[model samples]
Target: MYLFTACCVLCGEKVKANISLCEPCLQDLPRISCCCYRCGLPLKNQLNDTLCGQCQQSLPPIDYLISSLHYAYPVGHLVSQLKFQHHLVHAKIFAQLLLTTLQTHSLYHSIPLPDIIIPVPLHKKRLRQRGFNQALEIARPISETLDIPISTGLIRRAKYTQAQSLLNAVERRKNLRHSFALIKPISAGHIVLIDDVVTTGTTVYELANLLKKQGVKTVGVWAVARATHHYK
Candidate 1:
């Protein structure tokens, strides 16, 4: 039998079977350790609380947030390549990273495995322009690996809003107002929302609100990366 070697998607360094990043690159990755359990934002002093000050004051619509990496450096670059440059390999790499994170979290935390995965939808116009939904692309491999089905038609982006990254928190919220609509009734008790990166989180908040309105009991977010305060 012949053997095969894999190369790191980011550094192009040869890696062992079923992995992407080299040891140095993997060590350099900005994995989130101490973070708010609700929003997954990195915390300065974790202390006794799993939530940050903002979350303690007011909880987000989401029940839990699971993010693998911080939206910085190489992670950001990889997301950009998948989102803008149409490099599908990056999406596969991201899905693999997310799978690893979920497996690790399941060891210690009682993270509920979702009944179904719903990738944040894109507007039809945007989908036509881009030729692919990055969220769905990122979710495909994850769904396959985790044995969770993905539903692309459960939620629809009704409004063609401006990019969330270009707007402030208030503007982002306003932009997404009435932007998403549930396409059908959801029977799943637990649902996982998949996204490439979560910034101010206004987008997911809006989506979560809609899902809850439709009687989705639990809404969890699974993102490849989470934005830091500096980026937000």
Candidate 2:
């Protein structure tokens, strides 16, 4: 069977589905590398751990970091849409991609499935304004696929700091230093911290630090995208 139809595409390329991006534009989305196993940092030489020197010198509070895509190009555009445009449907697609990537990696198999999933909490003010937390939207699909329990009230944003986008590393660390706190006692267990994107790792570090202090075991970070920066 054959069918013919005409549809307008963003790039003026004919597309079967009605979508904002054409096939070529979608293909231009950047993918993450598998170099540094611990975090997704690009690697230079063979190393024992998949950790870059920057992470090694000043380690992230979480034990492991995994990202589905690099924060660049069309991927970054999609992230912006999901975050700012309220296109929450993108979260499921992003989570599925992450699941597929994780399933293929041998290293991911041995790690224990997180006992619980926690999205980076948003302050009440921001939550009310945005009408939703993007992190929670992403985490919901992941939790559904992995069959892991999710706890929204476990983590709270006690103080809202200046947007991380406006801060440098040192300032970012200071801003996030005391931003997070546990709402109630969380029992010790493997926990996965979910967020839409990670740049300097300040926010996740603060959350991981708090969880570790609370005696949680093996905290790992799972985010949709990570900023690509060369660690010299």
Candidate 3:
């Protein structure tokens, strides 16, 4: 059990303990009602949890992906508040939203849950500057709720690559090359990668490829939001 401040982080309206944001404020955020289960990108005129045209032709390395919200306006601002301003309580809200999406998508039948949750690692240098890894914080509550252990110290940043936000998709891919290394064997066959946002899909793709090469059976990405509805 955790305690949250009575006021919402965005509008300062009083909120319940179950959620940090007020209902009206929560409704204002852009949501991905129907997203491609494989890429986690919004799908137009399609049912929820269905594959998009791109994934239909060629499957991606990620076996499953889900992002509850679109990274627009207040959602992006809220992410910034947590990432930069150290508003940690927002992680719980993110976890709730993601859990809702996951369960909603799996309403008809059981969707196999990942064996472990691995929040994206931050290089020691970046970790020092940020004071915390937002991804890990968000993953913590989800792990607690689902009873899935959060794995750490397995995959680490091998090099402090340039920040992804400043780079284009090509540059982002290049920047992340050889950036992550597995320090030990991942015992879990199915794993979930947690991140604050999915922008170009470069970083997760790189890490997923690394895991696949090492004989991991499945990889799923559960992000708080997707920067764009489509892959860049």
Candidate 4:
């Protein structure tokens, strides 16, 4: 149990909640309803493959991506606080919301629940500065709730790249190329990539590529939020 004193980003009222943002803020968060099923980008209609325009042109390495909420308004501010302001506790709240969203979404039954939850790895330098990986912070509670095993050391960030926010789509892909390596056998089972947010998805795509190379069959992207509109 935790208490949050910060004002809600949506209604701007001081309130208590599991996360920093209040219930109204959470209720007001934007979501992606009209998006490709495979890659999670905007789409007018669901196709056979359910891949977006960019995804149809050249598929991302991952098979599918599932996001809980849109990366906008209070949700975006929550992410910024977790990443930059060091409010890592907010990740638990985000994970709870993710679980609730999954329960309501039909997509939940389409894929097998991952045998293991693997958080996107952070470079040693960044981990040292932040004192924690935001992805891992979110993954902890999710694992506990779902009773899924979590492997922290199985994946490693090979090197640090420039901020993904500063890079264009092409640059983002190039930046994350060879960025993640599986240090051990991740077990031959469904894998769920856990992260705080998905923008370009280059990070999760590369990780899925690495996982497939490591002998994992099914890989799915699970993020707290998805940036439907991004700078890059």
lDDT of each: 0.83, 0.74, 0.84, 0.78
Once superposed on the true structure, which residue ranges of model 2 sit more than 4 Å away at CA? 1-27, 44-48, 230-232
Ranking by lDDT: 3, 1, 4, 2
Report how far off residue 214 is in candidate 2 (Å).
Answer: 0.6
Task: Give the per-residue lDDT of model 2 (tens digit) for 107-177.
Answer: 57878889999999989988887888888887886788789988898889999778887878888888887
Which pairs clash (backbone N, Cα, C closer than 3 Å) in model 3?
Answer: none
Please say which candidate is ahead in lDDT: 1 or 4: 1
**On lDDT, who's better, 1 or 2?**
1
Q: Among all windows of ten consecutive residues in candidate 1, which has the lowest summed lDDT? A: 1-10
Q: How many backbone clashes does candidate 3 have?
A: 0
Measured against the true structure, the TM-scores of the candidates, in listed sequence, are 0.91, 0.85, 0.93, 0.88
- Candidate 2 matches the true fold with a TM-score of 0.85
RMSD of each: 3.1, 4.8, 1.8, 2.6
What would the per-residue lDDT of candidate 3 be over residues 144-178, giving only the tens digit for each residue? 98889998888999899888988887889889999
Please name the candidate that would achieve the greatest lDDT relative to the true structure. 3
The alpha-carbon root-mean-square deviation between model 3 and the true structure, to one decimal in Å, is 1.8
Query: How well is each residue in 1-232 modelled by candidate 1, as lDDT tens digits?
Result: 1112388777788987465677788888998766788887877667313888789899999988888998889988888777788877777777878888877774225756799999999999999999999899889888887789999879899999998888988888889999998888989888999999998888888999999988899999999999877233
Q: How accurate locally is residue 122 in candidate 2, as Cα lDDT from 0 to 100?
A: 89
Which stretches of candidate 4 lie above 4 Å from their native place?
A: 1-21, 44-49, 229-232
Cand. 2 Cα-lDDT: 0.74
Q: Assess the local accuracy of residue 223 in candidate 4 as a C-alpha lDDT between 0 and 100.
A: 84
The lDDT, on a scale of 0 to 1, for candidate 4 is: 0.78
